[model samples]
Structure formats: structure tokens, C-alpha cells
Target: MDLAALGDCLGTSSCLIFQTVGGLKIGLLMFLVASGLTLIFGVLGVINFAHGSFYMLGAYLAWQTMALTDNFYLAVLAAALGVGLFGVLFERGFMSRVYRGDVLVQILLCYAFILILDDLVIIVWGEEFLSSLGIPDAFHRPPLFVGGAIVPVFHLFIIGFSTLVAVALWLFMTRTKWGKITRAAEQNPLMVSALGINTSLLFAGIFALGSLLAGLGGALAASERSISSGMGFSVVLESFIVTVIGGMGSIGGAFVAALLIGMTRSFGAIGFPLFTDGLMFVLMCLVLVLRPQGLMGRSGG
Candidate 1:
């Protein structure tokens, strides 16, 4: 394309709107994964290196569930709940001993799990791209239109679902007793434990909840993208980047950073395609230089 064509593409109203919507979708997907990772880090004080593997497992499980039941909803539910249970077992059987252990030990334990889970996924799913077939026909059709630009209903649904999840999380964290205890434990676990709160149980629950969110993200993507081995590794890096940019352990920060990275990629593709991948890191670096603690993160933790 010539400069004139590129200029015209950049100036089109429909093009801009479509890109904005696309960016939001990407951001929402990242938020689903990053939110969980951040929550685990903030509350449990352990960096879950295997979180992405859980995401990959979720997608594979979703594929199998959809194949069996031929129902998209059931597949999603299975993926989330199954992965959550796996997380609980992991916390109880392995992570429990390493809780508050040396950072190196925690990292090694999680890293080992990542390798094990990767092999498990390959053994179960094989080395092929698993296609999503159980999606509703309506999801494939675009019902929304704007200025000659068509927008798929499924994309809109994803955005709506992500919003609902965010709201629900906020309510659970603020209104529920368990949520309150979880948050309080993050600040002072010893005190909470002294007060008769089962801190161990609370940590396990938080870990499971985080795993569930990651699984939900993976299941959501499985409907639109092909599932493959090592898929989680790529997203895990981005999720961590989002966590870092938003402020370690700040849910709201993760959300905002996800959007920022998404928009940067979308717009960068139009304006500076060559730098698209690096742009996110550049933004992250700038944020770090300006605010070491992150945009919303507290100074410590």
C-alpha cells in the first residue's frame, strides 16, 4: 500500500471504531487471565508460574467437554470448575508446604509443575490444533452494525461477560465475609490467623478462585481460537506484564493495563506495525520509570 492508502485507512471512522472494539476484546481476554495471577500474588504472596499451564489445561478440558456434551455453556463450566479443583489439590498437596518458603523454592516448585502440566496436555490433546466446533451459530454471525462496519454478537457478548465478572468480583470482595477475610489476610495473615481465621483454608480458596478465572479465560478463547500445546506460555508472559504495569496485586490495575496493552497493539499495527510487539514493553518500561510501584499498586508488596 502507498502512503495515500495508509492515510485513508487511518482516517476512516469505521476502521477506527472496529479497531477500538477489537482492542477491547483483547484487553478483556487478558484481564481474565491477569486478574487471577495478580490476585494470587497479592493475597498468597506466591508467584504462580504454573498458572498459564492451568489455562492451557482449561482449554483442553473445554474442548473435550464440548465434544462430549456438544454444549458450549457446559464446556465453559466444566473448564472453570475442573481447573479450580486442580488448583485446590495443588495448593493442598504441594504448595501448602512451600507457603512462605524461600522465593527460589516457590519458583522451582511452580516451574516443575509447569513442565509436568505441559506434558500432561500433550499426552491428552496430542500435538494437533483442536478446533472449536460446539459454538452456537449465532456467535458466528454479526448482529451489530455501525457505519457500514459489522460487529459480531459474540464479541459483544465477551465484553459483557467480562464486565459482569468484574462487577461480581468487586461485590464478592467487598460484600461477602469470606472475601473480607481474604483481603484482611493479605494485609496481616498472622493477625487474622490469631483471630481464629483459618488462613490456610482461605489461601487455598483464593488460589482456586484464581485458577478458575484463568480457566474461564482459556475456555472463552477456545471458542474463537484453536487450542494448542504451549499456548498458555505466551499469554502468561503478557498476563505478568499486565500485572506489573497495573501494579502487582491490584485488580483494577491489571484491568487498565490490559486495556492499555490491547489498544497499543491495535493502534500500533496501523501506525507502527514494526514496533507493535515491543510497544507494550515500552509502555511498561515508561510506567516503571515513572511509577516503580505501578499505577495503582501500593509501595510495598
Candidate 2:
């Protein structure tokens, strides 16, 4: 065994720290995207294939808005709100009619939406890699050194923002009456509906909220990365992996899985460069063999 190769694989203390921070940043973004997918599945019992398209839509909208207004905050806000509202419309116009249909119908509807949304993006954005220069200069500032490891300020910002959102979501779910009702509906939709709660409105709200989270993820990413068509599809694939590993309809599971995946991706490149791409798939297979319901998922989930 070559010592130099071993050392490179293990990485230095500073390199490890840098990778850890990078993992955290990626995990935060994954959580944001997966949260909505899990929420939608948990509440509506629908596996949304088009959730990622909404994320892509958010990034495009953010770029367009920022180009017009030259305001990063405003652009992000607008993108999230716009995509969320579109979700509401989509649920009302198409999804409501098929809520009671078979799973195939739901899948087809969402898949169709994905195609439609993709074409729309091409029409609007013209299929090029949009530059991220529209984002404010503040986001491109210098990095911070922790124990001699370099950490980008923007990545830290993402981690902090995601943490804050997670906390707020927890408080909302545990403390607010509406949030409590939503949770109850997730567990027992029939009971809630039979008790006079408007299930349609509840479902719409859940879908819209989930879409909003996805959009927020896209908006946050738009400033730092090059945007293009099919971006949503790529994110949705990873989001599906996170949701699967976390367990369908399990928010806490999604959070934990996101971090696990983030760290895996960050370190796998160093430790097992040749197998990094298949690492998650291998992990997913193992998890399935041991616990088909996922790490934090309930039985049959």
C-alpha cells in the first residue's frame, strides 16, 4: 500500500474540515428540495414527479426578476411566491379532479406537467446556461478560515438560512393550530375530512407549501450556479434519493438523509473517486435490504 495514496485518501485535518462544511451546504439545499416532496407525499399520498420542475421554474423566475429589479432578495421572494401560487393553480385546475384516482393517474398528471414545464422553460429562457452575475456582489465575498480550513461565506449563509427555516417549520408544525391540523390530516385524512375539515383546501395548501419550499431551494441556488434547462429534473432525481433514504412522508428522515448524502458525496470523491457516483446507490440498496421503510420512516412507508 502506498503511504502517499493513503494520506491523500484520508485527507488533512483542514481538508476534512473544508469537506464537512461543503457537505453541510449541499445538505441544506437538498433538505430544502426534499422537504416539499416528502410533505406532498406524506399529506396527499401522491408521488410528485414534477416537483423538481417547480424548482427549476423558481431559478428561472429568480433570474428574470433579478435582471429586471437588480435585487437579489426581491428576486428570491418573487420566485418562491410565484412558483407557490402556480402550484396552487395546478392543484385546483388539474389535480383536484384526480385526487381520488389511481396512482398511475397521479403519476401521469405530474409527468405531463413536467414535460409542459420544461418546454415552457425553453420558450422563456432559450435553453442557454444563464450567468449568475445578476446576484449581488455581497454573495461573492471572501471565505472564512476555521482552524486553517477555508469556508465560503455564502455557503455559511445557506446553512444558517436553512437552519432558521427548519426551526421555524418545527415551531409551526408543533405550535400552531393550522399546523397541528395539517399534521393530523397527514396521519388520518379520512378522519379529518369526516370531521368537517375541508380536505380539498387542506390538500391544496400542503401542495402549495411544498412547492414553495422547492422554489426557495432553486432561488437560493440560482445566484451561485449557472442556470439552464433540465436543472429541475436533475435536482428532483437527487431529491427522490433523499426522500427514499429518509422514507416517504418523513420530514425528519429527509433532513437526516440529506446530511448523510451530502457527507457521502463530499468525502466519497476523495476516498473512492472511481465509485463516488455509485456510492449513494450502494447505500440506498443496503438501506433497502435492511430497512425498506428507510432510516426514519414508519413501517410500510
Candidate 3:
């Protein structure tokens, strides 16, 4: 090929690769947020409207921790633990009572919690939006050269970290004794209790784990977007859409749906411009109408 043609080909290839990688990163973030909502709704039968509130709490906590210690890594860890603890408290104190209630009641309870959390957040963090938590200055290494493209080191870190988290969650859910017990409880709580398992504790543990995942998602998102109070409502809606699009109880489904949604959003924004968000909703509605049970969801009752 001539020099101009070769350069054009290379540029097209690089752009495609960049878009793919960017979509994957966005998908991973969606998975992180949706996984928790799915688990909480699937296993505990709690809609957990406050799940998004926990995500906001995580971002605020991470911001505070980073300010205190000047360490991003430590801030993430602290945010996870703090939000996880909050989840435990929420489940044990309020949610446990509504376990056997109807979906409407559960939703009402969660909505009340949401109102409380919103006020609490405002009281603590005020109404100002925080700046993006960019990667540490010390770790701003030169981009990696690949063909005619240069990829930032931070992007690599995000992809690696997300992969590690996904693998870790998979291992925890499939390999551990606790994981098996939790799954059993989800399938049949009466049977799990009859088998001598403490169902309450199991439920609490799942809630904590789910909240930790949401917290991690929020902390990671802070690196790209400004932290704000209203962010919780926006992200929670997306997470709910993702949970429904995936099977409510299927982690693999969540992962797949996340990627689909992320890529659709990314391409829609670039290609459709004015109809970006609307395009996402249209896709969601189509999925709901055509495959209500989701791609990986179990069929039948």
C-alpha cells in the first residue's frame, strides 16, 4: 500500500481498538455497580434502593480518606470497608424486619432510607461537587506504544484492577464455603435454615459484600467523574436497568449486559449525538420486550 493508505489503515485500526478498550472499561464499571444490586435483590429479596446511596457514600469516604492520608490506594480500601459496614448496619437494623414483606413494602422502606441518606450526605459533604480524583502524580508514567497508538498507564491500571476484581468475585462466589452457603440461602432460605445454617448472618454477609462492590465502583468512578450528591440517583437508575437487562440472579449475565450497554452508550454518544441517552433507553426497552428474562437468565418459573 502507499504511505498515505497505510497510515489511514493504521489510524482506523487504532481508533477501533481504543473504542473497544474504552467500552470495556465502562462495562466493567457498570458490572461493579450492577453486581451488588443484583445480588441484594436476588439473594435477599430486597430491592435496596439505598444501594446507590452507599455508592455515593463510598465516593465521599474515598475523597475524605485521600485528603487525610494522601494515598489513593488506602482511600479505596477505607471506602470499601466503611460502606460495607454501613451495609451491615442497614441490613441488620432495618431490612431484616421487612424480609418477608411484599415488594411494595420493601421498596417503600428502601425509599425512606434513600431520603434519609440524601439528607445525611448533604449534612456531611455539603452541596458542592468535588473534582475528579485523577491518578496519583507519581504513577503518571509515559503511555505504552502499541502500533501507531499510545495507551495511558492509568487505563491499563483500570482494566487490570477490574479484571482482578471480577476474578476475585467469581472465585468467592463459586469456590468458598461461605459462597456456597449464600447461594443455597438464595435458592431456598427455609431449606438452608433447616440444614442448620444461620440464615440471618448469611443474609447480612451478602449485603455487606454487595455494598463493598458498589463502594469500589464509586471510588473507581471518582477517578473519571466529579463526585456529587445527585450522582447516586443517576447511577442507581443505570444499575437497575443493567440488573433487569441481565438476569437478576446471574453474575455472568450482569457482566455481559454491562458490556452491551457500555458499548451502546459509547457508540451512541459518538454516532447519534443528540439521541445518545435516548438510544440507551430504547435498547433497554427492546431488551425488556424481547428477552425479559435476559440473555443468561433461566427460563420458566
lDDT tens digits, residue span 1-301, model 2: 2446436645677877888898899888999989899998988888888999999989998999998989899998998899899989998998888879998999899989999998898898897788862446787777889877899888888899997877777787789987888889988999999999998899999889899999899999887888888888879998999998999888889999999999888887677777766888888888889989988898952
lDDT of 2 at 87: 88
How far off is residue 83 in model 1, in Å?
0.4
lDDT of 3: 0.82
- Writing each residue's lDDT as its tens digit, candidate 3 over 161-236 gives 8878878888988999988887787788899999998888888988998999889988888877898876789888
Total colliding residue pairs, candidate 2: 0
lDDT of 1 by residue, 53-166 (tens): 888888998999998988898899999999999999999999989986899999899889988888888888787778864456658664678765667778888888987898
lDDT of 3 at 20: 61
RMSD of each: 2.1, 2.0, 3.9
| Model 3 clash tally, residue pairs | 0
Supply every candidate's count of residue pairs whose N, Cα or C atoms clash at under 3 angstroms.
0, 0, 0
Clashing pairs in 3: none
